[model samples]
Target: MYKLQVVKELHSSEGKMILDVDISVQQGSFTSIVGKSGAGKTTILRMLAGLVKPDKGSIHSGEDIWFDSNTRKNKVPQERSIGFVFQDFALFPNMSVLENLKCVQSEKDEEQIKELLSLTGLTALSGFRPDALSGGQKQRLALARALVRKPKLLILDEPFSAIDQETRIRLQQEILKIHKAYNLTTILVSHDLTEVLRLSDYVIEIGNGKIVRQGNTDLFFSNEGKTDQFRMTGQVVDLICENEKCFAYVVVGTMLIKARVEDSMNTALGIGDLVVLSLNDFNPIIKKIKP
Candidate 1:
């Protein structure tokens, strides 16, 4: 099992914020972290990976002591057995795909490296360098390299951000297969709600550097019934004509919002109609909203 109890402080030109988070996960479970950008998702992962310090609290992963504020015991990233797949797929420019996979281990790493390459569909591209591969291929190579060391915990930071829609779906399935095969303790940070619901056994929703809600994926995405409790501020601006349907253009002050039209309800709304679009009840994407 993995346990976390930490208070982290981050400083940047934008501002400073404290992240007080506490959570636990059992072995062979997939946990997902979801939040807007700059909500401390990456900070939480960095702290878990021992790349950042926490102002208070402690972190315990099974039998190991990762961090403790009072005792002042902190381990380095190399000391922890963590497999990390970055958004950029940080492959080495000087090495080929196969060579990058072998960098973390000695003579004992070849078998694992070969297995990862096969699993990630990178075996045929073993000789290719980082620049020669496409964006999706590079992402796969990063995943393969991360798993070659046989880490107990796998951390993925928006692993599908740069891939196309088709490749993204394929990679999601591949990750699920890998997780089940190794029985890995996986922690994923993602903005895609569908992917989170599909892969995670447990979901943690963060807002303002704190966990706002945490629960099982089914309970979180349940649509058996509906409610109108979620209301986001906006205004109707334009009517985008489509073939069989239409989209509403809602102007929330300087920003414009686009929502699918169901019926004459949008027809009733003319340009410059003040409205509050509700999304507090469920977590859904703002399809055409300008951030």
Candidate 2:
């Protein structure tokens, strides 16, 4: 088991907040941390990575002690055998895609490098620099680089936030595949609740620099009232008409969700209209507005 007990004080724009958390994670579990901005989600990941030290606490993985406040034993990032994927694809600007993966390796293993490049779909663009790759490609490179060391724990800090919806979904599927193939203990911090629900086996909710809740994904679904009646509100920005289908471009928060409109309600919706959108299983249902 991976055990963490932390008590730390953080100063933010709002004020000083205490982050006190006690959490235990089973090996090879995919866990996600969800919360509003500045809620210490990333901080937890950083602490686990050995980049940040708690004021008073200890982190242990089975028999290995990663951090212990009383003993003053805090292992460095390199010693922790952790793979971190940052929000900003922090690849070396001077290095090529292949070089980025090779740089982190403790030994020169050409076969391993080639395998990772193929796994991440970067074999075609292996010689390209970071600036030349698309957002999705760069993210794939980052994942490849992180996995180059074959880490026991994988940490991701909103790694998909910058990508488009389609690319984000694809990468999410890729991450799931990699996690299982590698049998890695993965921890992710994301603000996208839907993505958290889809990807995480265990979910941890953080607020005000503290852990608000932590449990299996079902517990989170129950707490969020996500029954069969899951609905969200958005504004109709534009309408796309094709063949026999009408798709409404709706702006929900920062996400522009494409929802299909029923024929009965097609003429009822217009630009700048507030609408309710629901997802029954995978099909989208756009509620008719009472205008």
Candidate 3:
């Protein structure tokens, strides 16, 4: 289990504010932290990763105390068992993909490096540098490098914000696969609400440098009055047309939802199309059709 209670002062575009947060996450659980810009979402991740110091409280995982203000005990970033993927790929421009992963270790292990390359589907491009790879591939390499240490906790801050929608979805699936295969506790900071809802088992909503709410994914998405509308992304499984009205069957994660399409919108939809499904007043509306 992971326990965190930390406070820090931050200065941003919103001015100075105290980031006071308290939350607990079970081991091997996938949690996403969501908030507007400068709401301290990234700061929370940095504190957990030992990249930033908190003014007060403590952070503990299992029997390991990562940080405690009372005793002035704090582990440096290298001392903490954490894998962090930053918003940018952060790969070494001068090093090849294989070299990047090898650099993480004091002593290189060829077998381990090869395994990570295969796991992240970068085996073919191991000889290439970050500049030669696509946006998706660079992010994948970053993930591989982070996992070289076999960290117990994985922290990602807006890792997919730069990628295209198709690549973003693919990377999200890759992240889930990595999380389960390694059974690592994962925390993601993302502004993409649909991506968060789709991949996270739990969600933490922060506002004004404080934790406004934290709960299961269902509770976070199902909560009413939080917004005027909610958006979800899914693949079209079936499409039916009757007279001027059309109905679309979309597979959103494990749940299948039907969305009604107006005649004017019917010309833009088809089976197997990836689309955004919005909900308002319990009614499904399709928007932002993806090619």
Q: Residue 102 error for model 3, in Å? A: 0.5
Write down the RMSD of candidate 3 (Cα, Å).
5.3
TM-score of each: 0.76, 0.81, 0.83
CA deviation > 4 Å runs, candidate 1: 12-14, 223-291
lDDT of 1 by residue, 1-291 (tens): 888898877665569877888888778899999888888998888888988888889888888999888999999987788999989888898899988988866357567887888898889999989999998899888888888878889999999998987688778889989999998999999987667755798988888789978888666545223434455565454567788767765534223345666565645655444455656346322332332
Displacement of residue 113 (Cα, Å) in model 2 is: 0.9
Q: Who is ahead in TM-score, 1 or 3?
A: 3
What is the overall TM-score of model 3 with all chains considered together? Answer: 0.83
Error of 1 at 225 (Å): 9.4
Model 2 alpha-carbon miss at residue 42, Å: 0.7
* Candidate 2, position 106, lDDT: 84
> Which candidate wins on TM-score?
3
Q: Which ten residues in a row are the worst by lDDT in model 2?
A: 220-229
**lDDT measured at residue 244 in model 2 versus the true structure, 0 to 100:** 85
User: Any runs in candidate 3 off by more than 4 Å, and if so which?
Assistant: 226-291
Off by over 4 Å in 2: 226-231, 234-291
